[model samples]
Target: MTDHADLLELAVEVAREAAALVTERRRAGVEVADTKTSPTDVVTEVDHAAEELIRDRLLAARPDDGIVGEEGDDTPSTSGVTWVVDPIDGTVNFLYGIPQYAISIAAKEGDEVVAGVVLDVTKGEAFTATRGGGAHLDGRPVRVRDVVPLEHRLVITGFSYQRETRVKQAAAIARLLGRVRDVRRLGSAALDLCYVACGRADAYVEEGLNEWDLAAGGLVVEEAGGRWAQRPGVGGKRLVLASPAGGFDDFVAAVEGCGFTAS
Candidate 1:
């Protein structure tokens, strides 16, 4: 039988190790390794190094499992399981010396994510979850916050690297701003999802997040009693929208009303 909790343990371990490596490298300073999609969408040497380290450690522990990562080519699955990883989820923040970046890792059995972890590098906090198991932060059980009114809920979001897409997002956000208590652009999707999971924020939404970016943190949100959904947004990129259960429907209506789903 596939042990989801066991997979969670392995993911947490690998994520922590990667976090340590990332922190050490950040202290030495960062250099731009390349750009993807646009000049502002940056990747650093530390990102590559951290991903390599994570791949090595994970493969060493589970040789037959497939691996997919932000910075590395996909390894096909042979053991009916795969790992989706984002060695550094907020690379732009890392490059700029911000402390919000994280190492996110998740285990999937077939198409379903069975286990996951998101490690905050600078904060040393690990958010973890397993299918059928509740979510946790540093071993403490966590759940989304209780009822919050529409006008008082704090929402977090991120913009796409594409300029045209961002222009649309800006307009959507402007519409959303009046409906919520406030908004935050934290530059880290993984952390943003975890924040929603743990009640740090009432909700989150973003477009253009890849599988590696959503796998771990999405699982965390579901396990924390929150609801998340993705839909085709502007330019056909995914628009991930999530909120605590108490106000999820209200939140979705607000998002759609804000023109987030308009192509």
Candidate 2:
């Protein structure tokens, strides 16, 4: 067994419990929602509520660990352990009853992610990984697909809600649409990366993601034999995620033609 696996066990437990709370509230009925930064960027009560639940449980379990979450802040410490969280990764979808959101939690040592979990609240799917141990979906080990040819790939991507960012992403989407099997914008970067890890979606690209949004999902993709890079996008720290063993070169070539590079 590995150290991350132990941490993963605890993370999985916390993430699933948070997911159940989200699903239960979603089923009851949603109240109206509002924007966070812009009108197009939506957030629901469930996001903050779930964050509170996950934050409390995780901090209680390990009081010394630092936390960085979408809804709140926990200062960095010298303890070398920090939990990065995006309690509800697709709050817009969750609010609209679209059923594609997730609870993303990650535990990191220093600057590296050691263990992480992404819980698909609507589907009851849990995707997890531990550094150097490999990635898994519901206890079954998973890996990236071995397909070649960008034209044959199913890529997933998303845009920032900001106006200028959305415009650039739209152009990029138009550039890639004609050359691939298909492109999807699922609205949940966490689930999108899990899709890349489990080989459901061959690749995922995103911009305007904070550290908490990409940390866990990035580790899952890496442990599953995938690749991850930070590309310049809306805010210049957007994440470009794919499989290193699964088509890294081609993914890079395809994406670079559109002028995205690490920020």
Most lDDT-accurate candidate: 1
Question: What's the lDDT for residue 34 in model 2?
Answer: 59
lDDT of each: 0.92, 0.82
| Model 2, global lDDT | 0.82
Residue 207 miss distance in model 2 (angstroms): 1.4
- How many angstroms is residue 185 displaced in model 2 relative to the true structure, after the best TM-score fit? 1.2
Candidate 2 lDDT over 1-263, as tens digits, reads: 23777778888899989988988888898764557768878777787788899888977877778889988777574567888999899887887888899999999898889999999887888999988888999989998887668888899988878887677778777887887889998989998988988989887777778887788999999998888887666345555656546588778777767645433
TM-score per candidate, chains pooled: 0.98, 0.93
lDDT of 1: 0.92
Model 1 regions more than 4 Å off: none
lDDT per residue, candidate 1, 1-263, as tens digits?
Answer: 57998888888888888888998898898899999989999999999999999999989999999999999899998999999999999999998888899999999999999999999999999999999899999999999988689999999999999999999999999999998899999999999999999999999989999999999999999999999998888646999998997788889888888988864
Candidate 1 vs. true structure, TM-score: 0.98
RMSD of 2: 2.2
